[model samples]
Target: MRELFTDLDIFNAIGIVGVSLYIANYTALQTGFVRGQGYVYPTVCLIAASCVLASLMQDFNLSSAVIQVTWITISIIGITRMYVLGVTSRFSDQERLFIRHMANGLPEHRARALLDNGMWLTADPGTVLTHEGEPVDHLSFVASGKAKVIVADKTIATSGAGMAIGEITYLSGEPATATVEVAEKMHLIRFEADKLRAFVQRNPDIGAVLEQNMANHLRSKLVSMSETASRAPVPASADAAAA
Candidate 1:
């Protein structure tokens, strides 16, 4: 029994524990219990690498020690990057409120990353964003002001700040169904469709959040259209017959 509990056994146990931590952390990230871009995941990785390095010191394997050291370095870099982003990308009070309401449960870091793929611009009234029957090459989020959705020279709907413009066409890969024109001086964030798609491909979590947000926006638009239809006056002939 004394022979079984040697220094070698203790070192092996530490290595096993370190490997277990690495596996557990990876599983947590894959299962969405933790975020890959967050500090906790990388910090856990750093601890795991440190434990592995300690076990390597007892065994004195050059190759294994080098690998563990590299792992530790990478983990440290990841932790530092997350910390810096968290500190520097802190939103203002109004921006926080707007993001909270407009983003619909998107994390701040992810929101910042998404915004980084776009450009902010102000449009004068009567600015045509998407022309009817034309391909939508870009999408925009209205930070302030309003837009008119028109088809065949007749207004179909009014959209205001917090609304996503060109999303339907962007998602469907179709030409614009209606012309979208700025109805007031507007602040907006615009993203070229190709660039946005590339960014989303690189960061799938952001894509998921964006898809969810667009779905919610579409649902709300549908609800508003339904309400408008319900409130419309019946035709004179139809009203007379009902009476």
Candidate 2:
């Protein structure tokens, strides 16, 4: 095997290793960055070893050298981005806020009232929390984990701990325009619409808190989407429509 490898061009060998490393780096990034499986590091290391082996060989070419360098450059950037993503995921404000909110929703005294009124906790990543274009039957709170609100095939926001999911539609008694999907394994607390309404009637303060929170969240999300769209480049078709 060693003798057969010796017959290959030195630069080509290095290039192959570099390409492998770059691929591994990007894959690791997609799978939750550094918190991902431990196998990516070992794969990267093996690729680096291959590059060293190639440098020791005799046959080398300009094409091989260029390919090898390109791979190395790409790998370095990919790995750096992976590390940055890991760091950001760990300290994201949105993530932290979700935790805080989940821990501190409507007072504990109100929880039983919700549960007695047909509210129950369910945890499932595969469950369809809400379907777009369908009438919402319940109001859901994120007791734990995260969910994405998808409107017209576009992701509107990721709701984390302490956030409610279906209040808008539940309150308006209208068909839902957005679908809520579990972005991560989530612990959802749900209340039947009729029961929720009864509880609100009895505990007006808690009801007000829930409504205000939902309205504020919607406003914040809209403002954020608008700002992001403003900063993004407009396609020719979109610009023509505006003109």
Q: Give per-model TM-scores.
A: 0.78, 0.47
lDDT of each: 0.82, 0.64
Q: Candidate 1, which ten residues in sequence have the lowest lDDT sum?
A: 93-102
Per-residue lDDT over 6-60 for candidate 2, one digit per residue giving the tens place of the 0 to 100 score: 8767566665766676577667656635322233564474466457446645555
Highest-scoring model, TM-score: 1
- Kindly state the number of residue pairs that clash in model 2: 2
Model 2 scores a TM of 0.47
Ten residues in sequence with the least summed lDDT for candidate 2: 95-104
Q: Which ranges in model 1 have alpha carbons more than 4 Å from their true place?
A: 1-11, 24-36, 90-98, 101-110, 151-153
Off by over 4 Å in 2: 1-122, 231-243
Best by lDDT: 1
Error of 2 at 209 (Å): 3.1
Candidate 1 per-residue C-alpha lDDT over 136-218 given as tens digits, one digit per residue, 9 for 90 to 100: 99988888899998989988788887787888887899999889999999888889999999988888777777877787887
